[model samples]
Target chain A: MIVIELSERQLKIIEIVKENEPITSEQIAQFLKVTRATLRPDLAILTMSGMLDARPKVGYLYSGNNTVSIISEHVKRTKVSEIKSMPVVVDEQTTLYDALVSLFLEDVGSIYVLSHGYLAGVISRKDFLKNIMGGTDIHKMPVGLIMTRMPNIVTTYPHETALEAAIKIIEHEVDSLPVVEKFEEKGKEYFKVVGKVSKTNITRLFVELGRQK
Target chain B: MIVIELSERQLKIIEIVKENEPITSEQIAQFLKVTRATLRPDLAILTMSGMLDARPKVGYLYSGNNTVSIISEHVKRTKVSEIKSMPVVVDEQTTLYDALVSLFLEDVGSIYVLSHGYLAGVISRKDFLKNIMGGTDIHKMPVGLIMTRMPNIVTTYPHETALEAAIKIIEHEVDSLPVVEKFEEKGKEYFKVVGKVSKTNITRLFVELGRQK
Candidate 1:
């Protein structure tokens, strides 16, 4: 009946440990992009919470029970804001050719449609493929035409649990979900694009939970 | 001072457990696309290995120590040949524009250059951007002229450890390393493309290792 709330950095540290146990604090600090002193407090906290075990010379080891349940709870209780990746976005007026270049340059599978900082829609690889197959003028066509429009776009609030967002990805068969926040302006509800979640994020969660330290 | 050899299926099952503990055998079978009866032995083996704790209702719990060390060792001992993605390849005679289309279509950062099944060179995203920005005629240009030819291509053997391959990625500052096998023909050395290992692959390896019972 022990419930521990872990920070994102803590979760990342767990993944690092899972990948390289018996690893020294120096190595952990290097991976975390922090000083060893800065990581010391976090390490102490994890060890105290029984999520990690530290020895004089053995470095650290996993020694937790029901870690899966903890992970499941983490996915259920943690907010989307905590784990979402920076959303790749584009203006609605961007040309298809420019969008294509952006996609390749950014190394992203999809890009969010943002019009004046508002969530407008989403454009995916499939959308591009379908459009190209139809022989649309890539140089002249705007991305807004081919993007999956809002209301049809599946989105989650920043406060929602990651599990809920993850379920959306599976159910919709989409590679990512944009995390949004709604606001009222001129009696109209509009969503502000914030972040994103992908299969990679879920897999990373699983990797963190898999550790026993 | 303990060594454990885990099969790919076993590793996958561990991931499932980490994501959804208190999960039933039937559910695991469904996820694995196998019969419950077929999964029973694996469940039993895991439960007996001190890696899992099973109960009538609570299902399974993680119960292992030094799992990270074991995973690190797993990376060091396991051969790249056992876990590599199918190489994305193209012929040297292929046009640069066609190669560009293939790169985006395949969603790969780099492609292997093959000449009659022999590894000849490699073409990456940078190469495409450089050539395109230089105003080369994409329609008439062959990929061979722009490729990083043999003796410059970074490669790993199927027999090498994943850890070694990962190190190569860091050292060479490449997104992936092509797995190849060397052979001699008519007093000349040649390489045959087999597989590939990218950051995604290494991350996947870490995820698999993070799992407990």
Candidate 2:
């Protein structure tokens, strides 16, 4: 947690130490703008802060400390395979209870809604939760009303890097991105929901990578 | 845990239903090289096995089922941001115990060894475990001998996609790849270890995307 306040003299000292650590005070004072007496106090402070190393003959050296924050350091760059849950989907006309069971049993954050075998809408846990709480008939309602509609869907390539995807998650403020595979059927285009990614998946990755250490 | 044993008739039924799900069994039977009675049995078995859905009159459709494995599915994808740990690392001269402490405390899968401010080698948790079982002096042994050294140390660019890296991991049969950013120091070359990518990260990405459903 040492935040080094750079002074002109300290910066010079840093440069000198950077060149060759274990340098003597006399040589530093003679070559630099500051006096050895003036430099002594700075040296002592830097050394004490663990930012600098001190020696009897050689004056000092930067501790060579370069550290990222603990949380960021342990961050794992996931692959599509790691975060993608197998698809849990239903027709736009399926009963709410059926969708709820799929979401619950799969333990997924969201579910894809298909229409005649086409990517249609995404139904999230929040959507289902809100519906269940609103006293709606579980068997009567279809997911199409509450589901996020198409063209709004965020997706990733089966071959994309997780770090890039992480950036997308942060920037877009979206919790997950579906992994999709394109197929041609009956001479037409269709997007098959193959897998899914969630924020928890990102957290789990760090957990696993962190466990390695 | 139902493994759909495919017969030629069953495969034909699947292909037809897969292309046009919610299409009636009569239609599938018409399209396939089979009779309606034969298709009815396949449809019944598929639905019972959680592979298809049967509506009274609308016909039979693949349920998008059984693709999600309950066992592997729970190992959720997580962001790299949540874990609290320093980057797992050590100098070339550091004893195996020094690396082990970082490994155990952080619970990470791998540790990188640095020398002259450059990555020299990587030691995986598996490596450490195997070595310990082989009766090596963890306290006395320097990791230089056991580490996967330079050139053998596979790397990835920070900008590369997670999907690409995952394929690389499978291709290389390595546990992880150091995310590398290259630069010149004193007109010479060096690589800064920016981050790391592993299988867990890939899995986490999938989880994150799935949750957004």
The best candidate by lDDT is 1
User: DockQ winner among the candidates?
Assistant: 1
Q: Which docking category, incorrect, acceptable, medium or high, applies to candidate 2?
A: incorrect
RMSD of 2: 30.7
lDDT string for model 1 (B9-122, tens) is 767888888788878887889899998766665665466445667888777766642133222233346578876988889999998878878877887768899988999999
Q: RMSD, each candidate, Å?
A: 17.8, 30.7
lDDT of each residue in B76-122, candidate 2, tens digit only = 22222231123577888878777776765675668888888787889
Q: Per-residue lDDT of A42-142 in model 2, one digit per residue for the tens? A: 56544544557777665676787422112221133346676666778889998777887676577565788998877888886545544543556667888
All candidates' lDDT scores? 0.72, 0.63
lDDT of 1 by residue, A110-131 (tens): 8898988899999876576556
- For TM-score, the strongest prediction is 1
Q: Specify the poorest-scoring 10-residue window by lDDT in model 1 chain A.
A: A65-74
The residue pairs found clashing in candidate 1 are: A51-A213, A52-A213, A62-A212, A62-A213, A63-A212
